[model samples]
Target: MSIHHRIATAAAAAVAAVALVLVGAGPAVAGSPHFIKNATTASLDGTSLVVDFKEAGLESGSVETITVTAHLDATFSCVNGGNNVPSDPKKTTISDEFSNSDDFTAGKNGNVVGSLPLSPPAAASVLDCPKGQKATLISGTWSDISIEDETSGAFLAIPGSFSF
Candidate 1:
């Protein structure tokens, strides 16, 4: 082949290699959910609600907080507390605190799964009922809420509806 043709072929190969590397090293897209396989699931067992969160985009071994808001249809009056109505009477918010595992690394493109048991004093005050009371969730809607990366001080809000 001519020297000119050989030089052109080498240049084309170099350009293609660089392009592939850029595509592979792309950062995680902003505003995209890091959670996979259903971000959250809440199961009501008797008077307690166990919420499991499966998410990503958080640093390993970091302390993270999970908040859940229950949306109700009307004002709920509980026997064990005061008026027991949310200022935003339509929704009641609850939070669970926990720490990520020492090896729980969900880099920019990974996932971390965690679970919290909402029981007794902590969960009771949220449900607005005394401990051991059969707290009925009532006809309402609940959400996964938010997840924060304590290590990086980054917060990601989990909307009620999301897929993949």
Candidate 2:
């Protein structure tokens, strides 16, 4: 073949090879369906329960809304004259469910790290205590903590319950 013709043929072959490689790698590069990675954690930041998680296989720069849900079991003690009120039920247990949602943007690597905060119920009220007593929060536990992809309505795995 002539010099120019040989060069043109070589360039076309290179282009075709590159195209085939890209086509073969397309699905892998796109990655699997988005999912919440393991090792997700829940902890307390002051009175608010914070859930931290990492979502993998997301589309880069895409936005996702995630919701964190947990059931809170809190204990409060009724006090009168700076001491526990023995006559009244000294301890009261409160159980409730709470959830919070936040938006997270995937990074260039198609992964997102985000945190959502859920506020615990307020301290017990006077109605929870004897007439002359005040209520004080003693301790709290968050159980069945779960993370969900609100956009897809899929629940993700979490470590376990936490205490505060």
Candidate 3:
């Protein structure tokens, strides 16, 4: 071929190669989730606590496992006083740890919904309110939350909290 024709052909080939690479990389990039969004506590009962969260930015299957440590506040305590007495506001603090990976399927905006069961002592601390008073979960601190990513093989730390 002529010199100009050869140069034009080379340039076109390079462009086409780059396009192919980008197209091939789309799936891998789309499968990785970078952050967790809409993470909220669905319910906090004496038995178990459930949290619902969705993956954001990228697609699902990036996070293989999510480990969470939660700090819970017990708002009321039953004092050893007589009947019809007001319950003391003596707050008790408790903690629990759990993990979930069910909702992390191969899709975008994946929802990871799961629960952690409380031990008997832990449940009693939360449910031991006196009569005429309701046992309450005042606040929850979700700390030391880590996610293991399938693509990167890295553990990412995420911290969050909520109040009732």
Candidate 4:
């Protein structure tokens, strides 16, 4: 072959090799989730907590939202006596019902867990709170995390703490 012809063939081969390597290096894509569930409740610490979920039937790129409720008011008292997590929030409107928030684009369809940070004002509301006491809303900051597929009613909540 002539000198010009040889150089042209080498350039084309190099480009093909680089493209193959890049495609193999990324994470695998998944299908949209079929089930999205999580849980939340009050923690004893009065300062922090833990939250997690299982992303089943999850797709590769769509965003998923989990809703964790942090209930408030005087009707709650973790140390003395408090109700379990609230069963009533009028109706899950993605706003008044969910007290805390987080976002995760599913990776391989599994649990996406994390620590939850919270303030008193972000505490669960029980219709009222006395001077020094607050509702049993996930204390130490806690598990008021909710995961919602909006179009679907698939979701969950749990309880935990962050007291340190």
Relative to the unseen true structure, what is the C-alpha lDDT of residue 92 in candidate 4, on a scale of 0 to 100? Answer: 16
lDDT of 1 at 142: 34
**TM-score of each candidate?**
0.38, 0.71, 0.38, 0.37
The number of the candidate with the highest TM-score is 2
Model 4 spans with C-alpha error above 4 angstroms: 1-45, 74-98, 110-118, 122-153, 157-164
**Which window of ten consecutive residues has the lowest lDDT sum in model 1?**
71-80
lDDT of 3 at 74: 34
Stretches > 4 Å off in candidate 2: 1-10, 16-30, 33-38, 46-48, 81-83, 90-92, 124-132, 152-154
| Candidate 1: tens digits of C-alpha lDDT, residues 1-164 | 99999999999999999999999896554343344436666565544445566666554444444443332231222332343433433334433332232224454444556665433233334555444233333333334544444444445554552211
**Cα-based RMSD of the predictions, in order?**
10.4, 3.7, 7.4, 10.8
Q: How does candidate 4 fare on TM-score?
A: 0.37
Q: Report the Cα lDDT for candidate 3.
A: 0.48
What would the per-residue lDDT of candidate 2 be over residues 23-140, giving only the tens digit for each residue? 8875334355345555467788876788888877777777888898889888887778666656646687879888998888878887778888887766665237667777777778
Q: What is the C-alpha lDDT of each candidate?
A: 0.46, 0.76, 0.48, 0.44
Better of 3 and 4 by TM-score: 3
Task: By TM-score, rank the candidates, best first.
Answer: 2, 3, 1, 4
lDDT of 3 by residue, 48-121 (tens): 44444444444455444544344443343444344332434645666656554432444554433343332223
